[model samples]
Target: DQQVKQNSPSLSVQEGRISILNCDYTNSMFDYFLWYKKYPAEGPTFLISISSIKDKNEDGRFTVFLNKSAKHLSLHIVPSQPGDSAVYFCAAPFLTGNQFYFGTGTSLTVIP
Candidate 1:
């Protein structure tokens, strides 16, 4: 079974709107959560992260929310732009091991 999963395979939003992506994990010991955005033929770049101690973290138009009890998290992008279109992935570092768990990723398209 996958430790981290992205429930939505794709999402579409109009420009200047909000784009929300959801993620879930089965592991309870994950302490660090990260979101990455990737363009075609390139490696993913880190966007935002939230520690387990905090429920929310934000950077400009990107925000991440963590719900430890539910083992769930979500990424929110406000005023979504056409340039924001990409594959967004959520990842969690394992507490007991060096390996990391990553979600399948959600493809987001911001329509002009």
Candidate 2:
């Protein structure tokens, strides 16, 4: 079974709106969570992250929220723009620290 999962395969939002992406993990040992954005043929760029100890972390237009008790986390983008269209992935390193687990990813499209 997959350790991390993105329940939504894709999401579309109008420009200047909010885009919400959700992810779930089965591991309680995941101490840190990160969100990454990827464009076609390009590598994923780190967006934002929240530690298990933190309930929320925000960076400019992006924010990541973690609910450790529920083993869930979410990414929120404000004023979504066409340029923001990309695949977003949630990831965390395993307890061993040598390996990491990533969600399948959720494709986000911001319509102009």
Candidate 3:
């Protein structure tokens, strides 16, 4: 019943190391990829995004990589920090429908 899902439900990374979060979607026509970070008692915040045409998008320490042919999405965080510890979700809205697919959140723990 889920179109987008994270490879793992959780991840742990040492501080200052690169943390790679992976997501896969079943929809082949997905045009946009979105990464959101959420903390306790708060709504998901948009962290970064990329269009299907672009293979990669970077913003500061966060980078999103998209592989259309593989229907894969990845969020890379360089120099992971404790403050970066949170639940991350990958989402994409159907280009022609009202449905939006969201990945089962991946809880990331950036160990200090």
Candidate 4:
């Protein structure tokens, strides 16, 4: 079972435009970043969430940035595509650093 459910809220972006998704954290113990993307008929898979120590990480058209001082995280998708349409989730690890606390996801729709 998925750890979190997607909220009714959603985001719609035009294809080939920049799509920015943001997340914020209040816990200082959050050392590592965790983001997941879920597609229809598939389980949520790890996307990109670099460690808090690192400011940014990128994979192809997707980029993730972490701001430790501000306790904020952002994922940037350049040239967004229809294939990128999915539910994106943000997660933080527990104090014990064993399990993770997942946030209600944000549904993203890419307008082709």
Q: Give each model's whole-structure lDDT.
A: 0.95, 0.93, 0.94, 0.83
Backbone clashes (count) for model 3: 0
lDDT of 2 by residue, 1-112 (tens): 8999999999999999999999999978889988999999999999898888789999999989888889999999998999999999999988677898999999999999
Give each prediction's root-mean-square deviation over alpha carbons: 1.0, 0.8, 1.1, 3.5
lDDT of 1 by residue, 1-112 (tens): 8999998999999999999999999989889999999999999999999999999999999999999999999999999999999999999988665888899999999999
Q: Which pairs of residues clash in candidate 3, taking residues 3 or more apart in a chain or in different chains?
A: none
The residue pairs in collision within model 2 are none
Show model 2 residue runs off by greater than 4 Å: none
What lDDT, from 0 to 1, does candidate 2 have?
A: 0.93
For candidate 4, the per-residue lDDT at 22 reads 79
Q: Give the distance in Å from residue 52's predicted Cα in candidate 4 to where it truly belongs.
A: 1.3
TM-score (all chains, Cα) for each model: 0.96, 0.97, 0.96, 0.87
Backbone clashes counted, model 4? 0
Error of 3 at 36 (Å): 0.5
lDDT of 3: 0.94
Tens digits of per-residue lDDT for model 3 on 18-104?
Answer: 999999999898898899999999999999999998999999999999999888989999989999999999999896648778999
Q: What is the Å distance of residue 49 in model 1 from its true position?
A: 0.4
